[model samples]
Target: MHQGGKFIVVEGGDGSGKSTQARRLADRLRDAGHETVLTREPGGTASGAALRQVLLEGSLDARAEALLMAADRAQHVTEVIGPALARGAWVVSDRFVPSSLVDQGVGRALGVDAVEALSDFATAGISPDLVLVLDISDDVSKVRRASEDPDRFERESEEFHARVREAYRSLAAQRGWVVVDGNLEVDVVADKIWSVACERLEP
Candidate 1:
């Protein structure tokens, strides 16, 4: 509705319904008459799609993972997010820099500040207008992914997921991102997300 559109991101642990909640919010925003663009990290664009598999499935050290994540974000912003926001279309992303911050930064023991600097360079200071961090426990994350073959990150031990969860909570609080209970029912979580969006961004 404004000159430059808003950028909103949904983040959480595995099986935290990030994709579902992101789509619902994007749809809701579109229904409200805002031009919305829904996308995700690791595969939001042509090049990113190619990187997605390797990033999600490949065995890489923390530094390598962080670099790849940043590269994906760079392309994602340059190709998809930048143009949409510049043209006044809202962008709703499932995951963004925060994923790298928690996953490789904390979970992989690379440090948040280090990954953040990398992310900032990748995004070129194009930060989200609003960030919705969905909080869920490691057990919930494991249960949700039990039926499917695990990805590189998912295959990590329970301790890794626990650390990732804690990092997300801590960093989100430090950054002023809205924290939502992802363990709630989908509809309930969606409603909460909508309310927070309305309350904070009035979108």
Candidate 2:
């Protein structure tokens, strides 16, 4: 059974409910007597926090963006994820390698193979055991983020977002990750996520 030291990554485009679902699933795992560390990419470590602000708020070249994201991931895995997993704790991250693969790789017109290679190098081959992709439409993403102040990536052109969303779908399918419809009701979505986790991670 997939128990100790397991790393589960929840991935999606903006407004796809990945963060909420990741937190809920991690909590459920903890409640079920698992030592779970709920975390997120680009902000998990202290160095990563500063990198997250620059990555999210400031504009940079596509290559720079990819490199910065990789830097954050490096620090995050080294400081937080690696230690937590080494001590027999399960780590559930809100986003991980897939986000870069879609955002910088597809959305920013960078090649997926290159971004993936960079990410793999950054993480030193440490990869997720499970990746749950919460999928939603572009319209839904816009509506859900309407009231919030848009970040650099969030303020990209609609076409960019379209590509990102499509890339997420394609990549998730290619990687055999679970694709959950994020248009469902919150409770329902949570139930579906939890059910899948139970099936896959439980003995």
Candidate 3:
């Protein structure tokens, strides 16, 4: 089952329904008989999960939080993503570098170049062949999940989310990512994502 291929990443801001879409995509891939691995960043592997709590709730300094994210990403890529890809499994991550680009790069006011550099190193040179960036307005996102506890990052004001959205838009434009509208229903969004992914999966 070791057919080589590039990794795929799905990234978006809070309440964009990334988790729902990712699960749907993974399920579709499985039904289509493709080996697929569904996972999330900041909490994929054991090490990353532990770090996720600290990064989301703890009062670490901005620099420290950024560094911890990078560390967690490194471990995730090495332990989960790399091996899965090596085994011909299609890795669909709910988040990846875009979280850092938004949460740390723009939200925390860290420069884009610095975040990109750290992300490049942490991923050990594995760049996602296709990055699906879901775009949604801050207002829409805020209302999507009213019951979920607001984490430290999620507790930020609308101004912060606006900046993060801008950052994601900029990255999508710069990287030619597959930009999908997150305002749609989960199945519709997954359908669009699947189309893009299937196109890329072709020889």
Measured by lDDT, the strongest candidate is 1
Tens digits of per-residue lDDT for model 2, 1-203: 23348889999888888889999888888888888999998789888889999999986999999999999999888988888888888999999999999999988889999999999989986888888999888889889877678888778888988898899889887887899999899889889988988788761
Model 3, span 53-133: residue lDDT tens: 998899988889889999999999999998988877788898999889888988998887898899999998776777898
Clashing pairs in 3: none
The local lDDT score (0 to 100) that residue 137 gets in candidate 2 is 82
Error of 1 at 151 (Å): 1.1
Instruction: Score each candidate by Cα lDDT.
Output: 0.91, 0.88, 0.85
For candidate 3, the per-residue lDDT at 165 reads: 87
> How displaced is residue 182 in candidate 2, in Å?
0.5
Q: State how far residue 168 of model 1 sits from its true place (Å).
A: 0.7
lDDT of 3 at 94: 88
Q: At residue 202, what lDDT does model 3 achieve?
A: 51
Query: Lowest-scoring 10 consecutive residues by lDDT in candidate 2?
Result: 1-10
| TM-score of decoy 1 | 0.97
Candidate 2: list runs displaced more than 4 Å: 1-3
The order of the candidates by TM-score, greatest first, is: 1, 2, 3
When 1 and 2 are scored with TM-score, the better candidate is 1
Residue 77 alpha-carbon offset, candidate 1, angstroms: 0.4
